[model samples]
Target: MRKIESSIDRRRITNRPIAIILAAAALGLFASTAVRADDSVGTVTQVNGSAQIERGGATIAAQQGTPLKLHDKVTTTDGSVTMGFGDGSSMALSSSTSVEIEDSTAVNGQNVPSRVTLISGDIHTIVPDKTGQPHSIEVNTENSKATGPSPNQ
Candidate 1:
């Protein structure tokens, strides 16, 4: 009876550490999963390149390879600010316009939703047909949100 009890106690002790380790590992995985890249914002190909973008009374250049985020104010000095999307879609920010790359994501690893908020300016875009899934392109103005050209248009 004594030996059996000892074995049972040892098993319980060993299982506790295993369970703790597994829990820690799961938390680590969850943290990493949330730190993914914002591919929908795509790459900046023209920062301070030629067009001077001013935000908050500061002039910042929009260059290629810059990772844009939400609320990053952007404006064009001479030409339009261009941005590429993961689904081959793109947007051109008109001069003297303030645009923001709001919420964008490639959810479920299936389709990407590229959202842009034009606080006060104009945006021209080219939407793509991504496979069979419905791709979304939303543009928000001061008073309204507009969807891109219809799927058939």
Candidate 2:
């Protein structure tokens, strides 16, 4: 009887820690899913004729769509426009260009976290410095691309 009681006590002690670990893991998964569901919206600060946006392997035309969100992409031809997103981050595009907004976040009424890929032609991005947050802007051409500190940068 003594040996049986000791074994049962040990089992209960081990199970308590395992249960706590499982509860913590469940909470983490829930938090991550909530974050991924967070939507980011973007607008055409400047536009002309017809423009289109791409994302998740799909393309969205300017007129047919309301707006765009994070991980969304944009394309243009024969016109130019500027895009402003949730965190005050903005990008200006020239004619005959295709670009992607890899990430978007907002800060102080501006889209501060931003990333763009210019598939062709030229584009200028004005990146804002948000407090202590990582920020990056990328421009891609057909053969190559560039990134830096300022829009003129």
Candidate 3:
């Protein structure tokens, strides 16, 4: 009976550290997810056909009103999606396109710094008129980079 009790006590001691480690890991994972959820920069205003949003190694269906965060990748298999940013700028992605939201922020209600990489296919953007402070929208492709409000403006 003494030996059996000693063995049981040892098992409890061994299991406690493992349980604590697991609990800590779970809490860390939840904290990171919460941070990502708080950093949304845009929303899927319209989605046609099939689309997905990839973030943090997970791919989720992209539907109208889906929030988009910086570093999020949006892919369209057979249709298109439109994303609208807080600064009133919007992007319309064509079918078979993959784009990553690189950086986006609105500062002082006057400037919106935004960029997207066009992995394939095409994207059309309508940037709202500049409000005094400089606004930039950079579209990058495999072979080219386009900056908007064209030089003619």
Candidate 4:
């Protein structure tokens, strides 16, 4: 009887830790999902005709004023789109173009570390004037990368 009771006690101790670990893992998964649901980075300011936005593992039609999020990919089939950031900077994508919003951060109403990848076609960007802190717009293509005009320009 003494040996049986000791075994039962040990089992209970081990099970309690396992239960706690499972609960913690569940909580972490829930937290990560919630964070991803609220990730908006910019907005589609202009849509000439038809555009599509790939976001959250899905592709959806894009229109003017459509909200954009991190890792979002924008594609213009027969039209064009203009994406505007919070810092007054904008990217104009030509027809048959594809671009991805890789990363962006705003500081004091200015864009910092703003970057985009042009998968195909042409894009024109207008960068806002810089403040004291260094700010730039980076555009990456399959073959090249372009950084914005210097703070002096």
Candidate 5:
């Protein structure tokens, strides 16, 4: 009887710590998912003709004010689009153009240097003028890279 009682007491002590650890892990996982689900990097400001956005392997029609997330692929099927990033930088994609939002970090209403990759077609980028403070927009194309505001049309 003494041995049986001691065994039961040890099990109870061990199980309590295991249960606590599992509960804490479950809570941490839930918090991480909540943070990842709300990550929006930019938005589509204008869409003329037809445009689509590919996110997480799913493609959806592009509309004005459509929020853009990191690694999203934008393709214009029959029209053009203008995307305004969180940093106040904009990219105008011509008809039949495909581009990818590479990286963008905003500070005080301006992109420290938001970037995009032009897979095909033309794009016009306009970045905020913070002359002495240093602000820029980066564009990448096949075989080359361009930075700063420029007209690619």
Candidate 6:
């Protein structure tokens, strides 16, 4: 019985380092997820023809899986483009359209507002309906500004 107790104690002592390592790894994974959440406000799902994304004065070709950040100006030439946002919102822009992302942030599972400026062209936006949780988004056109689909929508 004494020998068995000693073995058990040794096993428990050895397991402490493994437990600590596991905890540290879990914490790292959580932190990485938090970092990844801020990486992009949305993503480019499809680009029909030619689209350009101007970020901080640098223009890049927009393609599938391209990450979109805040203040990104996207313009579509010959064809249209489609984008999916973080807060269950999607936007489809027709050809000869220009849009700028004003603000978008996803933090700690909170629903925040996003703003977009439609410099030109036609766009169809869809925001999810979340009854009590109010999620608001706004779009600005050349002449007027309008709110997107609210929580009721």
lDDT of each: 0.60, 0.65, 0.78, 0.77, 0.75, 0.78
Off by over 4 Å in 2: 1-38, 56-58, 63-65, 105-113, 130-153
Residue range 42-84, candidate 3, lDDT tens digits: 7999998999999999999999999898899999999999988
- Superposed Cα RMSD, model 5: 8.3
Ranking 5 against 6 by TM-score, winner:
6
Q: lDDT per residue, candidate 6, 85-125, as tens digits?
A: 76667788888999998886564453333788888887877
Per-residue lDDT value at 22 in model 1: 97
lDDT (10s digit) by residue, model 1, range 55-132: 456666777766555446676656666776556766767666677666666644623435566767666666756454
TM-score of each: 0.51, 0.51, 0.61, 0.61, 0.59, 0.65
Q: Over the stretch 17-45, how does candidate 4's per-residue lDDT look in tens digits?
A: 99999999999999988866656677889
Model 5, residue 25: distance off in Å is 21
Give a tens-digit lDDT track for model 5, residues 46-146: 99999999999899999999988878899998899998866566788888889887786757643433566788877777666655222344343543345
The TM-score between candidate 3 and the true structure equals: 0.61
Candidate rank order under lDDT:
3, 6, 4, 5, 2, 1
lDDT of 1 at 53: 42
Off by over 4 Å in 1: 1-40, 46-59, 107-113, 131-153
lDDT of 2 by residue, 118-152 (tens): 66777776545544232444454644344544433
Worst 10 residues of 3 by lDDT: 131-140
Error of 3 at 38 (Å): 2.1
lDDT of 4 at 48: 94
Among all candidates shown, the one with the greatest TM-score: 6
- Native-vs-model 2 lDDT? 0.65
Lowest lDDT sum, 10 consecutive residues, model 5, at 131-140
